[model samples]
Target chain A: MSNADHHLVAGAEGHQPSLAHHFSSHRQQYEAGKLGMWLFLLTEVLLFGGLFCAYAVFRANRPEIFIWAHQFLDKQLGALNTAVLITSSFTMALAVRCAQWDQRRLSAFFLTLTLVCACVFLGVKYVEYKHKWEEGLLWVRQFQPAEAAASLDESGTSDQQPRHAGIFFSIYFAMTGLHAVHVLAGMGAIGWVLVRTLRGHFNRQYFGPVDYVGLYWHLVDLIWIYLFPLFYLIH
Target chain B: MKPGPSSGTNLTHHNDQPFHAHVVPVIVLLAVFGALLGLTFLSLAATWIDLGTWNLWLAMGIATVKAALVALYFMHLRYDHSFYALVLAAALLFVLLFVCLTLLDTVEYYPDIHAIS
Candidate 1:
């Protein structure tokens, strides 16, 4: 039923099972798949690149709002999530390596670890979002400055409020929200790979799925690398 | 044109080819991970150094380094076919172009818009 199994059925006939009807060899199929994945990743870059451009525009127009609005974020949590995602990426690479060497057990172990890291990253994101909502820091029109906020003046007045502060939160929510979705998707992909690995579906000759999933996971981590510094550290 | 059973025999040596997927060593992966974490802390430290306008650049610079490490090693781009890397480079170029063009228009109209409002 799985592609791998379909390929296995072909293999039983003394032909390469993983090789598609349109492809002549496993190498050609793998190269085609890799090329397709690269094209998909390029689209992903442009997709997020648009959001990043928006963020840069808003920040350029009102640097002070970014300076003030970002104070509500907890750098420690962001940093922790960064480390979490990076470690997960490492495990993902190791998972691909293990699968390449036909080390099934190690491959499964690393995939499981990557899944755990994704969940932990999402959990931390939830905590951070909950804190933001508690402080009335929603996106756009819903953004409300917390009372007794240090960004306020000595009289605790409203006049000292930064202009267009909500824009910062808007960009923040959009970028990180999309990224969190990717994290969830990455978790699903890794889970699938783990299932396949456990079922003895993947070996050195048929690990394209694992390799592609690992690349996707690394791209997720790569996006967060930029997001962390832009949102949490630049202030 | 449909191929027969013998079609796959030609490309079976994919695993042995140079353009085939690179199986990054465990030790290399760990080293890259360590470097990524180190650069992370270095960027954090840059935030505390009061670089003023330079702070943003420093943070971005360090983040770029970390991103490069992930792409080149962890993502195995360095070992992948050059076409994949070229695709990524082109994507980045478009991103830069999009941002620059948008900013140019924004910068030109900002003063007029600000005065009118």
Candidate 2:
């Protein structure tokens, strides 16, 4: 338009390194980032979809077996763990919000809190799994649900062998194990984002990385929401 | 190839405002958590009555509700663009189709299915 206006536009166009060669502005970058994350989440659903199929088919074939197997689980522990994961997912969302506001300290703290809750979920899982394993409750060898039910304690697992209960544990371990793996991977990613946030890599305009990861973490939590009841609290 | 420049630079407001209104989302999250806990214990209680076959569907229904809550609020999907939710719904529909078909043909794969059924 004018001489000074032309120069100012030219200077701005030449300034920021974040500007893509083909892109006209920053808004496009954020939308593309959001789109790409959604695509990845689609694949994640398919991954869990496979396990859900197996679970459905098995439960259909052996309804009585599943019922017997479920009686052995501690529903109280499962509920507590569900609460832990839901809270962690909330903190993760807040961390993304904080990062968007350029609050590095609060963002880092929330991420750490999220990680702590994740560890607690894994810890509960470990205890539940380990107790099952020590009592010969794993799939393959000695999966005695009757013994497990009667035992209530570790030593009680010695009697009443229903080896076919392995089917339930197999399904349980497969679904929850895969979900746990995702949780571990998410923890690593969150830790990386926390490190980057501490270094001031995210501002209001460029917190896409943290935002994307937060979305991912919540998806993982969502999967667990389905899993906690399907496996542990099965009626 | 799709359009003009990239996505981020096109929008005038990059949503600088806080994500949620006051602590509304937090309150919602706690409410969801409490409900999930309630359903979980309810599932446990129902397990004892031998709902015959209803228990499985009942549990799955409760679990699906809990999953929806996490997806909507915890993932910010409720507050994000509508497109993400659409894509997720499509993926889930596909998964449902796949599960139903697989179960329908399940008898063919494992011949022993008849015996068990």
Candidate No. with top DockQ: 1
Per-residue error for B49 in candidate 2, Å, reads 6.4
What's the chain B TM-score of candidate 1?
0.81
Task: Write candidate 1's Cα lDDT for A78-112 as tens digits.
Answer: 89999999999998988888888888999899999
TM-score of each: 0.89, 0.81
User: How far off is model 1, as Cα RMSD?
Assistant: 5.8
Best by lDDT: 1
lDDT of 2 by residue, A30-125 (tens): 558778998899999998999999988887766666766765567878878887887888788778767767789999999999999999999999
Interface RMSD of each: 5.1, 4.4
In model 1, the Cα lDDT at residue A63 comes to 85
